[model samples]
Target chain A: MITVINSILTILGIYFGIGLLFGIYFFLAGARKIDPIINDSKWTVRLLLVPGAVATWPFLISKLFKTEKQ
Target chain B: MGLDYQTILWNKHKKVYDKLILAFMLMYLLVFAGLTFTFNAQTTIETLIIRAFGTLAVIMLHIILAIGPISRLNTSFLPLLYNRRHLGVSMFLAAAVHGVFSMIQFHTLGNVNPVYSIFTSNLDYTSLTNFPFQVLGFVALIILFFMAATSHDFWLKNLSPSVWKKLHMMVYVAYALIILHVFLGAFQQETSPFTIGFLSIGFVTIVSLHLIAGFNEVKTDTKKSEKDESNWLYVCRTGEIEEDRAKIFTVDKERVAIFKYEGKLSAIHNVCKHQGGPLGEGKIVDGCITCPWHGYQYLPGNGQSPPPFTEKVATYELKLVKDKIYLNPEAFPEGTEVKPVNC
Candidate 1:
């Protein structure tokens, strides 16, 4: 039981860890493309996006590429 | 209506609202602690903190849930709805504190990770009373944390309003989990009539308010409209709609708001671009139909936001004949400029 729980936790950890790295990159570069207003938005506003970005990085990645294609 | 986004677009009203929230939270915590210590002198500081925050979060969750229905029932409660995200975040913060402190106090001495221990610390999955309620709470906290993280308009825009709304609706799931957690964990051990009664009352109140408000909304949506030979729906007379206000009706299963403003009548989609707020519930402010929930405004004529703001809603054609209003059920595309009919 512990092993199964640990496995789930590890997978979640890895997912969110990758998400964290992607979040940083997205905030620094890609966020502006998706939301042009972000270019002029305050750092605090940008900072507020971090947790959401991390949680939904896969969606963000797809959006980034979609925007790039556009 | 903002050209740029800040961390929070603070106004005097929001400041006052937040200050009131802070004062209320502090007073509640102090009172809870004082009462707990007076009644149970043997209670540890950790237990007091855990119980205090846990109960506070539960109360906050009940209030948060109630606000939606209350606002739906009465527009006067709409101001509370505007800053509701702050209350949600505050509730999540309180829940997180209770969860973390409880985990550390109960599970930190184990060999396994504390989070992992939440599931493994109690093996009794079959028993009703011995169920690992902490696990339910941990899961609820995760849901609340996710919701709190994505509560900003940034997520609403990026994820799309529909998707964001769906994701946030997981609050119902968290609410269920927390209810089970309290019943199985705290109530099982403490067995205090007061605590049990409080939880029962909160749960019943939230549920009853939602049902009442939901029935009222359904009554509006299910209203039948008379139709002309051309299939234009017959709405109420122009006089029925108050000046600068709207009379909402169901047009082809979609809600449409017909506003009477400055001797002209115009119709637009009732749902706001932001948060799906009911535009009909909001009065025309500054010559624009403002959303009651978030103040998202749209031009009465074009169903488009005023200059520098790009949000828009679908417009419907309206005809005013001898003070009788008729509406074409077919909607033009969002941002379509339909001419308003003079009343």
Candidate 2:
């Protein structure tokens, strides 16, 4: 039971660690590119997006790249 | 509106609403603390903190759940619905506090990691009475955290309203977990009549409100309007609709809002682009159909948001034959301008 719990936590920790790194870049640059309205948005709005970005980084990453390809 | 972004589109009303929330929370905590200290002198400060915040969070969750169906039943309650996300986030914050304090006080004493300890501390999952209630709470807190984190419009736009709505619906799951957590953990520890009665009342109230609102909506959905000679579905007489307001109809299994404004009638999707709010319950404010939930505006004629705002809803064609209004059941593309029928 302990081993399974530790494994699940370790995987979650790693997943979120990668998400954090990706989230920083997405908020700083990728967000504006994906949504033009975000270009002139306030710093507070960008800050507000950080946690959501970190939580859902894989989806945002796909969206970011898709917008770039276009 | 997806035109611009701010941390919060703070208005004077929102500011007042937030201030009221803070005041109520403080008042609740103070009263709870006073009662606890007077009655339960033997209880330690940590237990008091955990119990107080836990009960407060449960109360807040009940209020949050009730707001949706209550607003549906009475448009007068729309103002409460407008700032409901703030209430949700605040509930999550209170729940997180309870969760964190519980972890530190109970689990941190052991050598194992606090989060890990939550799951393994009680392995008697088969026993209903001896079930690990803290695990239920911890899972519920994670769901609440995800919800609170994505509560902003930024997430709404990015995730798409449908996806975001689905994600937010996890609140029901969280609510269930919380009810179990309180029942099995807190009630088991101290079974006071007042606590049990209060919890029962809160649970029944939320469930009843939702069921009533849902049944009323199902009536609308099941109402059949047969097509006339030209295949135009029969709608209510022009007199049935009030100026600046809409009468919703279920057409082709989709809800449509037909609005009477400026002596002309227009039809659009009943669902708001922002948050799936019922646009049919909204009024025409400043000549735009304003959503009752968040005040997202759409021009009644074109089903489009005014310039700089990009949100839109599907429009339907309305035909007036004398005093009886009829609608073409087919819908035009979103933001399509179907000339309003003069009544």
Candidate 3:
């Protein structure tokens, strides 16, 4: 369990670090002219989908995992 | 924009930005805390749900970080610079969560503790692909935490601006390390070629934008210095300054705005302390140099504030040599150190 977990974390650590670096460079490069038009556009909408999906994912996955009597 | 209109927009937009970050932080904590209680019932499906939320928080932080230098290089972006520490704190919280949750989900439940296993289980850290990437996250989080902790106006007021700025630059170094960490660990683990392409584009786009902006800021500073024209003595005759009026003179390549009013001559730095607006184009309002651009009022005699503000600009020593104005370019203490100049 520890090995699997450590392996997963190792991946995530890099994933997040890369995102941060990407964002930093993005900002620095566009500091002169970029207005972040796309980024600022209603991120809340994307965030809201999380709770909705969280509520539904378990329900959908549970049914598939259930055994049926023949 | 008019002062009142700018004021309204400034306040409204500031409120929206602040609330967005704060509300996001609150939601992250609430949902992540819920996961802790529901840990016993957790599954891969649940972990994926948390990951989705984590991704959302991370993107918002990127946006928040992007807003700073973007606004600094452009005056229009001043709204973002105003009280930006709140945004920093929010980013810290989001990054901290990313660190903690990954630790719990992947490492903590194992036979040995996650922290121990991370260093021990990981193969050759010396190798590029099999690096202990979580340590990078830990270090980055700590840097973010320090920045967030010092993100108050109190620190800005206490520490010199130069010192504060240098400390904040550490964020860039941390960010770079994080990117490398992810490139080696996360993308490697997922083994998704598509993710690699997407991450490369993201990195490229952001870096290019910043490089361009940084270069632009450097150019702006150079241009300002080169544009200055100065003369030994600019003879704008004795009555050049009328009561409540300002006259601009170039002395030793410095723009000196001399104001004459009520049989008195007052000379001050011709540039507004706020954003270096031209004070020569300004007016004397109630004994203060009222900047035309931003309306930042400065007293000509000593450059002190009317009250509740301490911003000041350079002042010059003036002398009427041969009935013509002979000015010394040496600047006196800005604001409230009144030295009499015989004019």
Candidate 4:
């Protein structure tokens, strides 16, 4: 059970990380401009980072180290 | 100038959070019924307290998320604008419980170092699947701690609005971190689709509201920018303004208030420096422009907020362009001499 949980956590971490990266890209690319309209795209895209980083945790654990129980 | 959005949302959301905190206490009663039956007497206390705090966190998250939209729908909600710090601090106090109790329940004692186990236990910061939810929580909590500590009006009085606004914007960063923490740390373990869907819906609703508000602001500002003319020419005679009352004029999206005191005419931004209350209608008290709402006093010549509150507003260049009394829309530093409109 511990091994299975750990594997899942590893996947969540990686998947969320990808989302976080994408959110960051959107934030950086759109946040600053003379025209404030550009910032909206950044904030909308940035919201994705929260759920993405969160969902990837289980997968992240599996890749980081060998699960002792596995 | 008017009350900018940062203050507006801050105000309305505060009332929402106030009502939210009160409502949260009622939920505390329902949970107690379950705790009494399921757990042993001692474990009941621990479990109830810990879980109750988690529920409080969830409640706070919902309130914080909801505040952005409720405030946008109304204008009278502006007074809540001044008390935003209290709301934020209250939210932090609620979140603190989850922060401390989680440590004691899951990570304290045993063979493992509490701090080390936080990063190591089932979380891999480097791995995509388990990239360390606890660390994000840790970082989020630290930022919350800083924000709560500095939420005092004392800080607002001392720090420039630009500096203070920049620091407060970190709440968005903290929110993102907390979002990840919950996803990996809690929902991952529970595996409840209902729970996951609820949280996702909550997040999406909030982001959509903020985006809509942002767009609304863009549209409003664009309209204002277009309507306000390049120059405002006034036909004021030399002694048109009086000492007790201010003559209000609009130029290039700026509200200019001309105050005549002791034979000199000084032009200042009509918006109050403290809360953006209209200064034109405000009474001149003790030789200063006092905001009617909060009594924020500013020296008219310099537009500087008086002692104990460091605030300022833009001062316009006053020029008598012709007998027609032409006023330049361009503003100058406070206390500097500019040509005046004799309209």
Kindly report the root-mean-square deviation of model 1 from the true structure over all alpha carbons.
1.7
Clashing pairs in 1: none
- The parts of candidate 1 lying over 4 Å away from their true place are none
The runs of at least 3 residues in candidate 2 whose Cα sits more than 4 Å from the true structure, single-residue gaps closed, are none
Please provide, for model 2 over A20-66, each residue's C-alpha lDDT reduced to its tens digit, 9 standing for 90 to 100: 89778877786787677887788778878887877788888888778
By DockQ, the best candidate is 1
Best by TM-score: 1
Of the two candidates 1 and 3, the one with more favorable TM-score, higher being better, is 1
A17: Cα error in model 4, Å: 31
lDDT of 4 by residue, B1-343 (tens): 1221131223465577667655755566466546655664555555666667655666566666556555655645544443444566677877788778777777896687564566567645457556777778877876776667545333333343455567678889988988777777565566767656767887888888788878865554344321115455562655565675577676654577876665556678887755456777666787887775566777777787766555777776555543323455677765454443334
- lDDT tens string, model 2, B1-343? 4467888767898899889988988899889999989988888989889988999999999999999899889978889988898889899999999999999998999898898889888877788998999999998998898899888887888888888889899999999999999888866677778777888888899999999999998887888887999898998999999999999889977899999999999999999998888899889999999998777999999899998788889999989888998999889999999999999
B1-343: candidate 3 lDDT, tens digit per residue: 1211111123566678888777876776567556655864554654654454455544554565566557645757665655465576666766766677787777887798676665666656677676777667766776776566445332333333455567678888777776776666656577868546766776776677678788865664343221214433444566666667777765455667887766667778787655465677677787778886556788878876566666788777666655566565567767645554444
Provide the TM-score for each candidate, comma-separated. Answer: 0.95, 0.93, 0.55, 0.59
Task: Quote the lDDT for B108 in model 3.
Answer: 81
Instruction: Chain A only: give the TM-score of model 4.
Output: 0.41
lDDT of each: 0.88, 0.88, 0.59, 0.59
Question: Candidate 1 — what's its lDDT?
Answer: 0.88
**Proportion of true contacts reproduced by candidate 1:** 0.76
